[model samples]
Target: MNIDIYSPDAYTTGIPHEQFKWLRDNDPIHWHAHPEGGGYWVVSRHADVITVSRDFKTFSAEQGFVLVDDLPGDILDMARNQLLGMDPPKHSPLRRAVITRFTSRRLEQLEPAIREIARGMMETARNIGEVNFVESLAGDLPTAVIGSLLDIPRDMWPQMRRWSDLQTSASDPDLGGTPEEVNNASIEMGTYGFQLACERKDSGADDLISLLINQEVEGESVSEAEFASLFVQIAVAGNETTRGLISSGMYELIQRPELYRQLEQNPDLIPGAVEEMLRWTCPLHYFRRTATADAEIAGQAIAQGDKVVMLYSAANFDERVFDNPMEFNIHRDSNPHLAFGHGIHLCLGANLARLEARIFLEEFFREFGGIELTGEPAFIRSNMVHGFKQMPVRLLPR
Candidate 1:
């Protein structure tokens, strides 16, 4: 079956459910020729996505950074070392260092601070009856939280958001720039991180960046360049993905007010509601992995070095996995959503993202009795980052 999953046009209408439905029914592991030279296998079924993610030895993230199109050599190298890209032995120790700080105990301690930030954001939105939900409210909250964690100056939060926005919005005509522009932004951010690391190394501040700089990993401290790359990854990844969750979650809730009211009436349902929101509006559409050896997935033969993309958005809505997959149910019980992904390469900041979303929603509804879109919301044009680009909303103060 000739599939055109790589075309940005196919995703313009959103998720391409019809195409995915066809793939799931006829060819769960379908191949499509890439417009940019190589081809990739599109993994549609939930079971296959889980299988591929679990069998990391066969499907390597390090082969190529998780995108349908191959990246430049330098960028590819940087991606290979990121927590999302590393395989086995190298991945373990770096992940361990950061995972320690992201533990449940640490998250619990950070709750009050996160809630305070959420409350403040809502208060600011409450003061202004009408605001761009994506910009005025949802966008900056994640940056502030992540910035605080990394000991980054609050004044630079907007710059961090700008860099992240540019990096992720590859399909938006206004935001998308030439490859040189993107690379320049990466360099600028990395330079900034290196400068910060140097200061932390000399001054010896007790913060996440300081810890990362000083702490030994596998008998040696993380190199300056590695630290810079890691810094960019954390700041950009944390900000973009969490922002998508907040903005997209609110958009979906307002569209399905019955479910929204259920959550508002029963605050206890917020956690499950967040999971359902993630299922319905999965922040990332897909992540790519390259086959390291010849393998058969779901009965389809995949050759070595062939690119494979796990369609998480489609998996979340897989009929076989999620009953009533299309419905936005706040009370969804067995929502085994792939929003945070799965297996060894699962999202490291999943807990923090969930906590941010739950608290943000609670505070939002508490401050505003109702949220309505003042105008038609706009979606980000990228096939990768699936979420709202602009959401003009009115906050009816309680």
Candidate 2:
């Protein structure tokens, strides 16, 4: 079957289960032409994606920076500085420097504060009676949490969110801006981050920004440009991906009231429930890696420099790996989902994202007895990011 899987339009109809099912069965490693030009091999099986993710030498994130479409020069340079784009040796040190901040213990300590943030967000929604959960509710948690981490001013959080939204939604005509507009936004955000770093240079603020600014790596302090890139990395990555999780998790629960009610009754199940949500609606559909050399994946020859997309969404539902693959079950044990990715480039903020989701849901169901969809939920028009762009819901306050 000829399928235009790369199109943004395909994602609006939701996960292309039919096409993926065919690929998983007939061609676990399938090649498809890109509409824009060139082509990529889509790796659908869970194990294959894991192999590609782990064997970074063969499939290099640094080679192409993990997006199917070739990015503009500025964006490409920005991506190279991110942990996601850095290859070994370099990737390890940078990721290690920031890893301690997002440990399970640190996230646990932040849970109560996150709970407070959730309550405040819910209170704002309750006062309004009804609000767009995407904007008023789900969107704020990531930005606030990330801003608090980076020492960015609360007033600046909204602008940070705007920049992140634009950066990730480059495919959506309605949401995306011109290359120049995007570049300007990045520069603005980066400049703001630099100023904050300079302020914290000697003031000794106990925050991630300060830690990064004060600490030295490889016996040398990080450069202003490197710091700016790291700043953008934490700000945008933490904001957009987790925001997608919260919004998509809610949309899924509201649609599956049985699952929603189950969670409401047994709040203890939320942690597992959150995992299932991540697996079921893996926010990032796929992340591309370029072949470093001529390689073979599942018998398909991939030429050097060819793009290979690890379809996390498809892999999460791989029939061979997941029992009852399509079903959204909160109790699914041994999930092994790649929502935050895997291997050396695994998400540095994975624990934080999970903590935010768990606390947000716990607080959500505790305060509001029931959540009902008041209007259609809108999906972001992009292949890379998957989640609701607009989710209208009524919170039935307990």
Q: What is the lDDT of candidate 1?
A: 0.85
Q: C-alpha displacement of 325 in model 1, angstroms?
A: 0.5
The C-alpha stretches of model 1 lying farther than 4 A from their native spots are 1-3
Backbone clashes in each candidate structure, one number apiece? 0, 0
Model 1, residue 41: distance off in Å is 0.5
Which 10 consecutive positions of candidate 2 have the poorest summed lDDT?
A: 216-225
- What is the C-alpha local distance difference test score of each model? 0.85, 0.85
Cα lDDT for residue 282, model 2? Answer: 88
Q: For every model shown, what is its TM-score relative to the native structure? A: 0.96, 0.96
Report the C-alpha lDDT of model 2 over 1-398, residue by residue, as the tens digit.
87678988888867888988888888888888987777889999999999899999999998789888887787788778777888987877677678866777877788887888888988888888788898888888888888877767788888898888787887778677987887787778778777877778866778888887787766767656677878887888888888888898888888888989998889889999989988988888999999999998877888999899999998999888889988888899889999989898888888898899988888888889888889898888888888888888888998
Q: RMSD to native for every prediction?
A: 1.5, 1.5
